[model samples]
Target: MTDQKKTHQPQPPIAVSPDEAARLAGIGRTTLYAALAKGDLPSIKIGTRRLILVDAIRDWLAQHQG
Candidate 1:
């Protein structure tokens, strides 16, 4: 019998939940939701779950930077 070890690689997330988006943005969930509601942040609805793209989060933050 031979045993094989599996190797795992860490990859950046393409999409994140609202809570995760809030955490990544260093903001509260309410603020995240407000941004989403205002269309300042982009999100997608899937099976009653809302997810934000990592790129969108980055761009949104970049847009707000002075």
Candidate 2:
């Protein structure tokens, strides 16, 4: 009997840094920040770092889509 090793796939992050969120959303950092500032998008701040939820980014984009 041969034993096979199972391969694990990496899961996507639930939250990401602002820069990464911007890249994932296909928007400029400044635009992303503006949305965050305007309360159009939600983010969480830990220490001095800001993180945006991946789901929030997706929902925001969907809401703004023409």
Candidate 2 residue-wise lDDT, 1-66, digit = tens: 899999999999999999999999999999999999999999999999999999999999999889
Minimal lDDT window, size 10, model 1: 1-10
Cα deviation at 29, candidate 2, in Å, is: 0.6
Strongest candidate by lDDT: 2
Give residue 62's error in model 1 in angstroms: 0.3
- TM-score winner: 2
Clashing residue pairs found in predicted model 1: none
Candidate 2: C-alpha lDDT: 0.96
Q: Taking the candidates one at a time, how many backbone clashes does each contain?
A: 0, 0
Model 1 TM-score (2 dp):
0.84
RMSD (Å) of each candidate, 1 decimal: 2.9, 0.9
